[model samples]
Target: MKLHTPKTLPYIPVAPGALPILGHFAKMKNNQVAFLEETQKKLGPLFWLNAGFGQWTVVVTGEAAHTVMKNKETRSDVMGGEGDRITGHITTDTVSIKDGAPHRRIRGAIQSPFTPKGLTVSEIGALLEETAEKRTSGWKENTKLEILHETSVYALDIIFRMLGVADLDLPLWRKTYNDFVGPWTMIPFNFPGSPRWRSLKARDWMDKEFQKMIDQARATGDTKTMLGAIVHGTDEEGQGLEPKELFANLRILGLAGHETTAATVAWMFIHMGATPELWEEIREEAVAADSPPTSPKDMERFPKIEALFREVLRLYPVINVLTPRRVEEPIEIYGVKIPKDTSVSASLLSLSRDANLYPNPETLSLERWTKQAHRPKPSEAVQFGGGPHFCLGYHLAVFEGVVYTTIAARRLASLGLQPVLQGEIPKPTYMPLTRPPAEAKILLKPNYKA
Candidate 1:
């Protein structure tokens, strides 16, 4: 499969600035979003880089990315593994690591709760509001809040509740859950009082909790929560997940679903600070509606706010690069020939920032989507991702945003979000995922309910 490129066909080119051993790792670490954008103009979309050692990462953009998403020659197992480092959970058949029929089976079995006709939006909405209230109860006049930390817990609470944790256990569950997943980037050395040690302990706590949820659902024949969906839902062939598959996938849902939604909402809050007028826009979403959205079904009532959120995703995408896909067979795309056994990933940032796909791509304008004629092709924001492996929680994420902002708008009628430093908003960090600065602060004040 390593045949030399035909004289007629060009091999994929390497992006500039590959420092000896570090390759493009150093440059990407500094600012990957900018690096990809700048490189796209100079290198022409698709390029390869050595992250380190002999490992090669192929970066695809535009048409190439769309092709990769829909192609069978690529598989997702190249990125995530059977044992997840981030979650510290291991499962041989987790959907993210499996492909072909097994992947389909696992994905199908768990997908019902997220599907349009199956999810109970009202219940989820009620839970979301309850969680939001507790998380934001600290918000008072001139209160300084770190958007990322708040949104992370807010999103985590929603996920846990959906998986059947009782409201009373939410506070402790959240703390344990955070400790469980927080060691992904830390140095890996197992010792007492270490992050890894805490994570392992957290994992043990999660295992017991998940097993209880599974047992209760199995015993009661209940299908109300996501845990039940995995236990009872069937695939196309009418097969359900095995106990191992069910538990493994259930453990992964929090890690998989929480981050994207949290990062997106956090970015939205940053926008709320930069453009205080948007608060009225958010308020109007709830006001103009016949009634407030008590369920995901009511998201349609808030098109203006929906458009605003879509634009935020485009300008500030939560996914900088889709999980890298490994090429399984030789293929040619976009006039470039890709060899087998190579690591390739689609760049969501490239597609989002493409001027051809979006006019004035850098600017945030709702009309880009709200206006029928101005909407770009492949309309839904690609930030959630594309292809067969597109985000499983895409629908839930969208509805959650609509539900959250509407509730916030109505509750904090006088609330205003202003930069804590009172100047131009800083650029978001873009590695692992795109998110607002951890140190970024906002002043919330005079939010007397109307």
Candidate 2:
């Protein structure tokens, strides 16, 4: 494959804090958000920062960020060579990361479960409410819990059930999956029992397990679960998922489907806990009250609940940076040429915080979304990357968040309760996905009925 384009156009401005082989590593590791924010203030939207080992990371802010995300010449299929190498190319064919025709085919074949028809099924809605109720069922005064950890359990349960894999060992599944995804494995080493070695081993084990599910579904013609849908569904051209494609995509889909939603819900808890009065207002709008959602249409029935999730997603996007996009051939954005095989990404956080896109960007206001009765198209969704590669699971994620929040709020309201968060407001994790800090805790406080 061609690795570079002819140097016919002037290069994008390069940020200047290189320190030999270390590059910008010192400034970026711990203080990335502050570093990027300050750089964007001075560098104006788009610039390249050296990331050592001959790599240049393209960082774009504001409108140019959206341009890169939507540009057809830019490919989201590649992150870096090492991201896929350790897991035997586990994500090489994932629908969310593939480009062009392959992406279209896999996305079409596997998206049955995320569509309105798929989610509108009465059982699916009931399942979400049941799961939400399960998560909030045991909370009591003085309860000590990490919000992120709690939401993660809820999200994983939902995605696994949807995939018909709930019978598997979920805690073990997440741990193994985490091993495969941990950043430390990016070291490119594969010694036995090392993180990279364990990641590869986990992928192999997970693949065998998924293949068995696929085999059973195809034999029985099972069509109830999301896994079954992918097995039976076809693309517009009547193409079906190849085995490796199915395995790879299922793995990424499970991770993407649950983890991001979990992180977003954790933020929802933090915000809602801080504002007890808002919970009363939100609970009043939850027509379901003490029960789970009754039907697929119930997804849209709770306006305040939906807006609460929307505002939380906007203020604290779980995926701050869209996964790396690889430039294909030559592409120009804001008059700067990005050559073939160049890796870049857009900052969802920056775009979400842009004053032009969101007024009072730092403040939380349900009015920003509720007044407009906003349901954003994927192409314009700021928190979820906008464009062809926009998150395919947006509806499912939102449904899960809305259902959980509504149930939790309504359940608390029924008991004359509100969550009073303990400890200082938690800060975002220093990781790429901005989950609420694991130590942040919440406890019950009394508030009158909805």
What C-alpha lDDT do the candidate models reach, one value each? 0.71, 0.73
lDDT of model 1, residue 237: 96
Report the C-alpha lDDT of model 2 over 208-303, residue by residue, as the tens digit.
888888899999998777778888878899999998788888888766877789888888778778876776667677745545555545655676
Which portions of model 2 miss their true places by more than 4 Å?
1-31, 50-55, 80-88, 287-291, 294-296, 448-450
TM-score of every model? Answer: 0.87, 0.89
Candidate 1: pairs in clash: none
Worst 10 residues of 2 by lDDT: 1-10
lDDT of 1 at 224: 75
The digit string of per-residue lDDT tens for model 1 on 269-357 reads: 67777776665566666666654556656666777677777888888788777766777887787876787767787888888888898
Q: Which predicted model would earn the best TM-score?
A: 2
Residue-level lDDT for 52 in candidate 2? 51
On a 0 to 1 TM-score scale, where does candidate 1 land against the true structure?
A: 0.87
